[model samples]
Target chain A: MRVGVVTFPGSLDDVDARRAVTLTGGEAVSLWHASDSLQGVDAVILPGGFSYGDYLRCGAIARFSPVMAEVIKAAHAGLPVLGICNGFQVLCEAHLLPGALIRSDRRTFYCKDQDLRVESTDTVWSNAFTPGQQINIIIKHGEGNYQADAETVKMLEDENRVVFRYINGNPNGSLHDIAGITNERGNVVGLMPHPEHNVDPVTAPTRDGIGFFESLARYLGALASRTQGGTA
Target chain B: MAKIIVDVMPKPEILDPQGKAITGSLARLGYSGLSVRQGKRFEIEVDGEITPERLEQATQAADSLLANTTIENYVVRVDQ
Candidate 1:
């Protein structure tokens, strides 16, 4: 599988995201924010960072980047896309996912090892994990609180779209303890935690994040086989 | 040139952490009975006369790019 990790200006974790992809046996393709092309990669990952300096809003300006035009289009066409941290903010700003991320309830930046419960493994990005499984991942952000209207929250719950929920304690005070979510089609996913940061055993406290990349590779391989079978 | 000013504010039902922090800070500083709701303001310059249609256009633009309607409500008015 070839995964393209986009590096917007001020992007800090694109390299780690690429390394995670490579570690999971996928080709990591470097992509730029100014380019409109996706480079024909099978999947795309928008890594964490202060894109456009997190100006105005966390992802308000970066959503208009040329690459997002293609990302949005391809995402709607059933392409698998994952947005981590600042990338998750970008996805929300782009309206690919519902709701918004406001300042953390504490109004301070938080960096710690977060415990997350896999609320749903129905999406392509989370299939490797079973529902209700607890995973430890790192989270770092000041404006990571997730919120949505009550109606939308109900809808997401009814549809089983809420992907991950914070366990033990709510770090940022996200509504319903939501840490990650997927679109209705399950092709696009966005999470506030840094899964890529946990892929390496030497640096990460646990190799728990390897599940995300492994899940993506399995999903892409299954998708490719389905396409080939359809043609055959 | 005409300027269209847009203000985007968080929905009343939504929690504004930044505003809450400010309110707390003010209370600590001996301020009382005051509340704050932080918002954003944008000034846009248009190339033509500011007509009702232009104002409406700016309003529409505000809905798409200037704000996230999911959690915010925006008001557009011509800059006097």
Candidate 2:
């Protein structure tokens, strides 16, 4: 499997995301923010960072990048896209996912190994974990507070589209403690935490993030089966 | 030439941490019975005579990029 990791001009975590992709048995392909091509990778990732220096609002400028046009198009065609941290903000700005991330309620950045519960396993990004499983991932951001309309929240809850929720404590005052969510198609997933930062035991706080990368293989396999008319 | 201004403010329902911090500072400095909400202002210069079409375009820009309608509200008007 090949995973494309897109690097925006101000992205700081693209290298780590590429490494995590390779470490999880997938070939890592470096995708550029201006190239306007996906390079035919099976899946794509938008790594965390202060894209475009958080100008205007986080991920607002980056959404207009040339590469994002292709990403947005492919995402609609069922391309598996995983957006982490500021990447999540980009997805929201791009309208690929609902909700917007606002400044932290604490008026300062919060960085820690945060606990999150896997609320759903139907998405391609969370299928490796059981329902309601708890895992620790690195959460570092100044604008991780998630906000959405009440009706949107109700619909997400009713549809089981919420993939992850903050546990132990609400770090950024996110509504309903939502830390992550997936599109209705289950191919696009966005989260405020940085799973790429904790994929290695030697240089990270926990290895719990490997599951997110590993799940890609399982999802692809299931898709292959479905194409072959084997009940997936 | 004319100036088109776009003012953006956090939605009333959304928390404005920056604005709240500014309020705290005002209180610390002995300001009483006053509240403040921080927002952004953009000034766009138009070279030609301001017309109805240009005003509509400015409003569209405010809606499309100058403001995020999800958590913010924006107003577009002529500055000069």
Candidate 3:
């Protein structure tokens, strides 16, 4: 399976995301933010970083990049997309996902290996884990707090769109201690933690992060085979 | 001309430590009954020639760029 990792100006985690893809037995393609094409990759991952220096707002300017135009379209067409940390910010900014990320209540940058519960495993990116599984991933950000209105929050809970939740403690003040979410179709996933950084056991807080990439590979590989059979 | 107002706030589920700290400070200062939640507001001026589509585009721009949706909520209104 081939996965594309988009690199926007100021994106810090693109390399790590690509490495994670490669380690998971998939081809990692480099995509530029200024490019309009997706390079025909089966899936896409928007890595984290202070895109556009987080000047106007985190992930704000990055959302307007040319690549996002294609990403938004492909995502709607059932392409799997995963946004991590600042990537999550960009997803929300681009309206692919709902809610917002704000500064933490601590009002300071947070950095730690976070424990999270895999609340929903139905998403393509999270299918490797069972519901209620505990995983450790790194999180680093200043404005990682997630928020939404009462009605919207209720809807997310009711629809089981809430994908991940803080297991140990609220690291960034996310609503309902939400650490991640998936779109209604379960194809697009966004999370505040850095699973890419945790794919390697030597560097990861734990080996749990590999499940995310492995899951995506397995799903996309199956999808590719299905397409081939249909064509035959 | 059209006037647009934008209001932004942290989602209620997310904890607002900054707002709480401010509330604490206010209580210390003897402003006992004051309630505060931190957020942002923007007032924009639009030309009368702007179409509703264009207005919506501008609002989306404001939402995507000017506002942080992860921790903020925005409401837009156009005043005649």
Best by TM-score: 2
The TM-scores that each candidate's chain B achieves against the reference are 0.89, 0.94, 0.76
Model 2: per-residue Cα lDDT over A23-57, one tens digit each: 88999999999898899999999999988999999
How would you encode candidate 1's per-residue C-alpha lDDT over A75-112 as one tens digit per residue? 99999999999999999999999999988888889999
lDDT of 2 by residue, B5-45 (tens): 99999999889999889899999999967788889999999
- TM-score winner between 1 and 2, please give it: 2
Segments of candidate 3 deviating more than 4 angstroms = B1-64, B68-80
Local error of candidate 3 at residue B7 (angstroms): 7.8
The TM-scores of all predictions, comma-separated, are 0.96, 0.97, 0.83
Off by over 4 Å in 1: none
In terms of TM-score, which candidate is stronger, 2 or 3? 2
Clashes of 3: 11
| Alpha-carbon shift of residue A59 in model 2 (angstroms) | 0.2
What are the per-residue Cα lDDT tens digits for candidate 1 across B19-72? 998899999999999999999999999898999999998988898788888889
Show the lowest summed lDDT stretch of 10 residues, model 2 chain A: A223-232
Tell me how far the alpha carbon of residue A37 in candidate 2 is from the true structure, in angstroms, after superposition.
0.7
Q: Write the per-residue lDDT of candidate 3 for residues A82-124, one digit (tens) a residue.
A: 9999999989888898887878877889899988999898999
